[model samples]
Target: MPTLRQQLFRIKPVPRQKEDVETDLKRTIGLFSLTMVGVGSTIGTGIFFILSESVPVAGPAVIWSFVIAGAVAGLAVICYAELAGSVPVSGSSYSYAYATLGELPAMGVAACLLLEYGVAGAAVAVGWSQYVNQLLFNLFGFQIPHALAYAPEEGGIVNLPAILLLAMCCFLLVRGTGESIVVNAIMVCLKIGVLIFFICVGVTGWDSNNFADFAPFGISGVVAGSGLIFFSYVGMDAVATAGDETKNPKKTMPRALIAALIIVTSVYVLVAVAALSAQPWEKFDGQTAGLSAILENIVGSQWPGTVVAAGAVISIFSVTLVSIYGQSRILFTMAGDGMMPKLFREVNPRTLTPVKGTIVVSAVIAVLAGFIPLNFLAEMTSIGTLVAFVVVSLAVIILRVREPNLERGFKVPFYPVLPVVSIIGCFWIISSLQIITIVVFIIWTAFILGLYFIFGRKSSVLGKQLAEAGPTNPESARTDSTGGAK
Candidate 1:
């Protein structure tokens, strides 16, 4: 038997088979559909409501926060592209770390991914609830009561609309990925137009005075704000998580990742700039339906607010759907590796999707959305995503050194320097997060590692395969196209 340390340090083999032909997941996602997954998952949560959370911390300098967060996310996704090309599997950075770093590190990445996708889904659902209320009030002149629409911490009994939104997303995800992607694509286009409408009308109210106190909180505040706003960029990596379901993923994944990044970042900065110019940064705090409220303030009418709120209602549904989809798929990958329960990996024959896992993921996310405060959820998501991005950047370097001839369809520009910067940038933002958030993250990761020692390490399919092949030639056991033991 191999030593405990050796088992922990074992890396998964880089897949060399045809991704399209050898996977259980249907390869129906093209570049456009995949890019929409990223966009649909991202745009809904942040630009629509994050200003209320971030602008308070960085003041009008939240503009810089958006740019900083996007820049770091850009670098990380570039490295992610290379790894997705090399590993060509589901599970995003978790699988990348397994292929390059080791089993233990992969588990750590899994903990981070759970937070990145699952928590983010809940966080966005909470934002969707706020917009739902706005839409209801706009059109019907009534809204869900505070006790049912806001979290307990936010002075409400529970967030009903958020839970309802998550339930709707769960139903769609259980149906199929292809169907979900098409619906998400249509929503993406509509929301983009709605955001553009907000921008055009918002510019009309630009006072220029909002710039006078841009950096009220200085560098520390900017960094902290980036941490909160980083939650907005979480969905970009959902592209990589779809590797198993993407057609020609090697070429398609990178293109989709980059395209999604460009579109999301551009829309984010424009929305931030337009939002700040229209109102003083201080007014953003406590604004539940942020964009719609801002537009109503600027136009002095209900129609513009109603329009934006309606668009947000439509668009955020797609965000919740994609977030649940990504979370369930990551768990599916983990279960296939024997790192999680078997139910997560079981696919329904009729739907061709992991129905059980999707339902479970939705249940957990519903509880989170219904109870947790959005700011706390958002920060936790940012911290988790930052750690995952750091791992992906490091994995890029490790893979380059370990498998110099690996067949990668995409490569990071500037090589080691870019990935190194990505690592540093991610850590920088992580450092600025609230101490409590950091403490919670450490506790969560340790808990996951504990589970590994008690369960995953013993039941790992890779460990069994390695034992069968003998420690002297562990590489011979090999993993399948799905990153499970072959």
Candidate 2:
């Protein structure tokens, strides 16, 4: 068996030929663009839809839940920035784990991310369907049947709009129509614009009495709500993933991560305050399209509600595209590293995108969107993301002690203290999740680990090279460890 130290540092970084990798993404994505991607990918659905679910748990104190979740996510992103800057790779936490932990561990991380990005896309699509229906109802007094708009658990047959949205995203990705930074920026602005409009109008209808029993369920409720709301902060790590594409990553990456976190947290808090102040927390339960509902309440006319619903539909579509893109890229990186099937590693000769992998992932997400209930999908995403964040927090400490000499452009401030705190925070939040979620997560991890040992371990490039080279071919073994040819 290989020692953990050897596994962690064994990979000698491979220098990719510029021609082999897609140059389209190589152009520097500046801090502003990167920050917008983070905000755009994150600020949808959760605010518009999840408030109904969370308010019942935390009451008006759901605002504190947002604050707690954002703080933990911010800390985790700091650690992610250090790892991303040091590795400068595309696989996000999976790639970081490969360089800092080992092959098997990296495979496990990739499995978890499949849950995080792919299923989250499905969940967001479901939310998009609700807003789309709301828009139609407000505009023309026509609505899709509830059976087509929701899942069976919610007393509906299928989520047709969610499936359609996922399919549309799939077609765009397959055609290599990648989302440009400009488009992402525009979407972010639109989402924020509508949200601000709702907040301003909604505040005018504020009822101070609604906050009287703020912490209705007490501290436990606040913690549970934090776990539920943590899904809103999921995309903040997009900043860390852009390390390879940033101009002057050392300076820009950290600044962008912190800035994005602060902006997203502030927006979430403002929206939460606006919503809670406008009505009693109990009224939020089962309210589809919460923001749109607030708009309707404020204006006493359907026009403003229609506008907010339209904004939500458009922005959530973009969020699905961004998320599915991220998921495909992570899988492509893993395949390139020889952890997955070679088919996933194939990049389109014409578009320079991972066409094969993107299609495969899109198909899976489409099926999930068609069947899975939105609430279950959201909780599952939260569980996977929280686990991955915990792994990242731990990896920072492991790499620091194991490599010590590795070049890192960005470092997490406060060293050991920050990472420890991040780990504790992650654990606290994840613990508040339902027992079923914990059980499902454990089973998923075990299944992935089994697959890794059976297939990934034996066929892994590093393992094969180690078997063939004995002790003399150190460079070959290192190249294999890095997931490329020597």
Candidate 3:
């Protein structure tokens, strides 16, 4: 019997006719489009809503949280850049892990990514509804019934607007990738426009007294807030995942990744500063539509809030669409690897998209949006993403030592130190989360492992291929049309 380590490290032969797999993704997305996708997906709901939750924990120290989260995210992106350039596959971390770490670890990473991408998408959808309702109330002097706006336990039967937004995104995704990109770019501009407006108007109302209670809960609070706000930085990895689609990925990938990170971090910091200057951190808690609230305070009129609200509603919808797009693509890659059901891998000939998987994901998200509250869902997303980021950071170290002679398009600048810091930073943020988050995370991991051992270990295409051909038979190894292993 093979040892666990052997099974875990067993690399599968690349599929024959690899050209087919390589050509699956249309190479139409460029650096500019990729950057816009990253910005559009990263900036919306987290900045609009999470500040309210995070500020209560860290007071004005939330700014440091933004800094810390951005730094850690930057390190992880550097590592991700190397892996993405090397693999040039569509699975994101899942494919990279499979190539270097083996099948089982890849499946585990897939589960974590499901949470990071799918659940996060749903959580953002819920937040979009909150902003939409706020906009309606501000513009028309009418509010959606509280029952239709919130999830149960918050005294609502279901979040109708959230469900509607999610459904619309699914339809858009099914149409085609080109449409998705155009819509994402438009949404990105709208969001940035509103944020610029907020900054300009908010700065005028700045009161230095709000900074008086900075760090009210001390350094620990800052670390805790960093953990909560880390989700805002999650979309930066989207840039790295476009490795196969980019032109001259070795050069293009790093430029786009670093550029996106800098842009996202700067926007986050500016927003935090403007928010802090506008009001005391204590007042941030429970303030839905945070920028709109700032606008209301600044202009002393409902019009500015209405404008901010409309912008937020449009932007959040786009964020949800991009996030769901990422999730569906990740699942498709896993399915193609034979780690998940083949159904997920099936692409509609007409659309060239993962239709079944997208539908299933949309269904689950709709159910969650209809039932679960946003706060709990957001924490769950943060925990999953932090865990996945740590895994990717560690994988970078393992790949460097194991495949030292392999050609890498991009290398992490500081080597072991940056990755080590990334791991530590991710762990610190994970620790700051609530005990319930830890518990739920443990349960989720356990369930994933259980599924892997039961189904993945036995039926994994890689394992079956290895058993048939033996590890040393280069002749038996599969080759794609491009003469590359899948």
Candidate 4:
């Protein structure tokens, strides 16, 4: 049996020295394409669908909720950028944690991120089902049978449309990233334009009466609303996940992170304020395709609503694709570390993408999107993301302390204080979540950690290489590990 010390920690250093472990992924993504990846994934389901659900909890105070969530997301991204710029690896916070905190905790971070990306992707696909149905219903005056569109809890036998959507994204990803993110970039532009249109028309319907009871549920509501709305900002870290495929990670990663942060935050705040102004907050409670519903109610015509619904249907598909893409990359890196099946690490020689990993990820996500209740997925996503952000913040501090001279293109402005604040902010929001989300997250993380101790520690490629290398340098170890192969 391994000692407790051995069982709980395995640190992964920067692997550029290891030729055998080099992922060999093509670095074809430039800044604009990378930024669009962030924008594409960040703007999905949350803003498209979270508003109506959040309004009842927050009233017009929901406006503050969007801002609060954006603030925390912004803080967390700073820590992620520092780590991404310094380490420039593929697994995101999962890689960051292994660099700074060691492998046991890296696996823990991996577990949180796996939940964050998977549940969020599933949630987006489920959200996409609603808009797709709305689009079809608007154009033809006929809807698919509910049994084929939603989960059992939502009064359907299975969410078949959502499953089909996930499968479509999987196919696109296997085809390659260049084609995928180009389509995503165009979708990002289209979705933002549609949201701007929402703002334009919604402003005309503003009523002072809606502001009268803005805090009906009080400050508690604002905090609680932030927790719910935080899900909207989940995908910003995905930019960091592209570190390996990015051109000039030191410059491009931070630029894309800040740009996507500003774009997603501004767009979300604008959408929330417009939707709140367009209709009474109470009316938001059950407004399915709520943003479109606001436009229809305002114009007393279905055409404007149909246009918005069509944009949503077409655009959310990209969001689902981008989000799922992030999850596959993270797992791909884990496989490269020998923490998952090696087959997942195999980059397709033709496409330079992890086709096997994408297929496996899409299959698992399809089941979640098709059968699980959407609300459960949303809350679990928010909670797991909070934990992952906390890990990233802590990783920044640990990395700085352990390797002060590490080259960093973008060091966080305030250093230790800001990282601590990032950590505190994540926990504060986490505290406001309902009991069930907290419980489910606890159960899920515990199970993942358990699996790590039982199987992962013995299998880590970096750990085995280091064991064999003793105190020798990484270059010598690399020669032996790969027999000097390119």
> lDDT of each prediction vs. the true structure?
0.88, 0.77, 0.76, 0.82
Top candidate (lDDT): 1
TM-score of each model, paired residue for residue: 0.94, 0.89, 0.91, 0.93
Model 3 segments beyond 4 Å from truth?
A: 1-5, 12-21, 212-217, 241-248, 474-486
Residues 298-413 of candidate 1: C-alpha lDDT, one tens digit per residue: 88888998898889888889888988999999999998888998999899998889999999999999999999998888777777888899999999998899889888889999
Give lDDT tens digits, candidate 3, residues 1-486: 567887777764333222123645556677778778778877877777779989999999899989988998888887887776555556567766776677777777777787777788888888888877777776677888999989997899999888888889888878877678788888888888888888888888889999988899999899888877887887766665554455556556666677778888998888899989988888988887777778887788888888878887887887788778777877776665556677777777877777888888887888888788987888788777677778788888888887786666678887899999989988877777789988987888778778877766776666665667675774464533112334
Model 2, CA-based lDDT: 0.77
Give me the candidate number with maximum TM-score. 1
lDDT against true structure, model 1: 0.88
Clashes of each: 0, 0, 6, 1
Where does candidate 1 stray beyond 4 Å? 56-61, 152-157, 207-224, 280-288, 484-486
User: How far out, in Å, is residue 373 in model 3?
Assistant: 1.8
Q: TM-score order of candidates, best first? A: 1, 4, 3, 2
TM-score: which is higher, 3 or 4? 4
Model 4 bad stretches (over 4 Å): 1-4, 15-22, 212-217, 471-486
lDDT-better candidate, 1 vs 4: 1
- For model 1, which pairs clash? none
